[model samples]
Target: MSHILEWKTRLYLFEEDGTTKARATLDTGTTTLTGHGAAHRNPADTDVPEIGDELAAGRALRDLGSQLLDIAERDVESVGARSGERTDPVLGWSL
Candidate 1:
């Protein structure tokens, strides 16, 4: 069977007091998840806004991905199946 679903994601970034912050949101029709991250630049380092943005955004996305995996694991356990029973080739690790 083929399933067609649409999920929406939005990422917002901002800087304050030499710190860059990022918030990422994912909407999966039935549930919504959010992740947050921050990056602080050293005073002695070059003040690069783009670098800060990249660091914060990457961290936020990583957090969001972890949350997604947690939810999937819980869902599998809810159905009386053990989570991480098998390894996924793409992920190269057990779920």
Candidate 2:
């Protein structure tokens, strides 16, 4: 059987206070992205901690997505070279 190992990512988001929030740990086995923030919302303020959490989480997930895409692209190129497959022009030949 051909053994294929895959990388996995995990993301977590939560509120820290009434107006503070965080997005913690975008992990891909060996790498992680973390973000924190203070929403600074008052009784009359339009902002909320949930907004902060969403913003932070979105940013973290975007970063993680980019990294994961890079890893996948590299792996695909590696496999294509090993198997003598014609890779897409955009991907090009790695070696």
Best by TM-score: 1
List model 2 lDDT by residue over 12-91, tens digit each. Answer: 66554454444445544576555433344456766556676676667666665566566666786676643333344434
The per-candidate count of clashes, in order, stands at: 0, 0
Clashing pairs for model 2 are none
* Top lDDT prediction, candidate number: 1
TM-score of each predicted structure versus truth: 0.86, 0.46
**Per-residue error (Å), model 1, residue 83:** 3.1
List RMSD in Å for every model shown: 3.1, 6.9
Clashing pairs in 1: none
lDDT of 1 at 36: 92
By summed lDDT, which 10 consecutive residues of candidate 1 come out lowest?
84-93
Every candidate's lDDT: 0.87, 0.55
Give per-residue CA lDDT, model 1, range 1-95, as digits (tens): 99999999999999998999999999999999999989999989999999999999999999999899887777777877645543552234366
